[model samples]
Target chain A: MSPFVLDDRLERDSEFVTALGLCQLRLLKDSRWPWLMLVPQRAGKTEIFELTPLDQAMLTFEANLVAGALKQVTGAKKINVGALGNIVSQLHVHVVARHEGDPNWPGPIWGFGTAVPYDNDRKHAFLTALNEAIGS
Target chain B: MSPFVLDDRLERDSEFVTALGLCQLRLLKDSRWPWLMLVPQRAGKTEIFELTPLDQAMLTFEANLVAGALKQVTGAKKINVGALGNIVSQLHVHVVARHEGDPNWPGPIWGFGTAVPYDNDRKHAFLTALNEAIGS
Candidate 1:
């Protein structure tokens, strides 16, 4: 298994919070947008294709489950799912909720604004609410 | 094999265009944002998972292949891949190249602005270039 150390980017990212479930379901600390980061428990794995077929299934299942719950909680009109490891190069999936009037409306959400760091109380509330939403 | 028909959305959106390849690749024609719409040879299917496992693999491979070429052409900082059936519900994958200064920068690409129809020449050029890049 790839050792589980948050890459400097993810670790220093005030946006990353605690994981929620047994599946290493970590919440990205990004509060500007309702985003979730899921890292399946496999070491040194950087791509979805890198996982065993069974693990791939698990990841897809969990990703879909969380994507649905996040949509319900965020009430986002659209949900964006992707794995762009260009910067982090880790096998993490991003599930972002998109709204109609978001800053980068109708555009890809990559190089938009400065990463809005999350504060402690807000982070706590968001994570707590997400956990409640998923009933985990 | 699923029968193929031009999606109505493809017809209405002047920005929609067909990909130059042995496969049925079509996209939103006028999206200056390097947005591609890949319509597989299926009738009334929306989600990528709906395809047979082999078809899914082929589509994913094709999408990634296009994404790589787009990155080279656009030098986008990030590439976003998604399949949202809210509007078309047809099994089409979106591979959009995102730059930092894009209109929808730092946000999801939905409800942003009116679709800018591509000029015939530019549209032809893009398709031609894409074909060359894909070596079709």
Candidate 2:
């Protein structure tokens, strides 16, 4: 495990999934879509450039792993993966599965409509399947 | 070097800057912003999972290297990086340096405005500095 701390914004917003090599994968609380976030457990690292080359590589692996599983498990039409630090500024990679008619179909998902927080039972089932898919 | 080929869409749209591991870094001919695209030269590969683990790691290193250089050379306020395969599903990574009031502030830069292509002299100068910055 890394000597890193989770950002308060992420902790408060997301439900913890599991940890990968250099990232802690979290499920965004939004029930509108299947979205997973990989937060690198590197302290004070807001940008990808701030990470060591090795950590960067490991991050890529973990990002791909999570994205692949998310796509397969959800049967999404498309998968969008990005690391945008405009608002949170904490180095978090978002892996979102997109469908043809999802709320924000053709545009970037940031600053979109309100997030529908997941209910307890649904969140449990979804996370359980996701954990198995990601082999966590 | 791997036997990778550039996609036709990228070749027609972008100006070749240099080659990094797992990608060919190109300047998205738009002069309005300092935008660069890293297209993984792996032929016919559209997803990150298609890449070998080592190549994925190498791609991460290259993306960070280019992003770091771009941030320094442009003195940007923040850098936006993502692998959005919406239009062209050829697995290209975008590394854009964003300023506070650069046309689209506090938002994603995709499809914001018309792209103003760079002129020969300006492109040459910019790429020259970029080459040194990224150690190409």
Best by DockQ: 2
Candidate 2: chain B TM-score against the reference chain B: 0.91
* Each candidate structure's count of clashing pairs: 16, 0
Q: Please give, for residues B1-136, the per-residue lDDT of candidate 1 as tens digits.
A: 5567767775565343445332356656546577876777767665454556556556656666677677666677777666655556556666777777776565655557677776778767777787677676
Categorize the docking of model 2: medium
Task: Please tell me which predicted candidate would have the highest TM-score against the true structure.
Answer: 2
Question: Relative to the unseen true structure, what is the C-alpha lDDT of residue A5 in candidate 2, on a scale of 0 to 100?
Answer: 76
| Angstrom error at residue A126, model 1 | 15
For candidate 1 chain B, the 10 contiguous residues with the lowest summed lDDT are: B14-23
In candidate 2, position A70 carries an lDDT of 84
Query: Measured by TM-score, how close is model 1 to the native structure?
Result: 0.59
* A1-136 per-residue lDDT for model 1 (tens digits): 3466656675555344445432466665556777777776666766555566566656666666677778777788777677666566656777777777775655656556766777878777767877787777
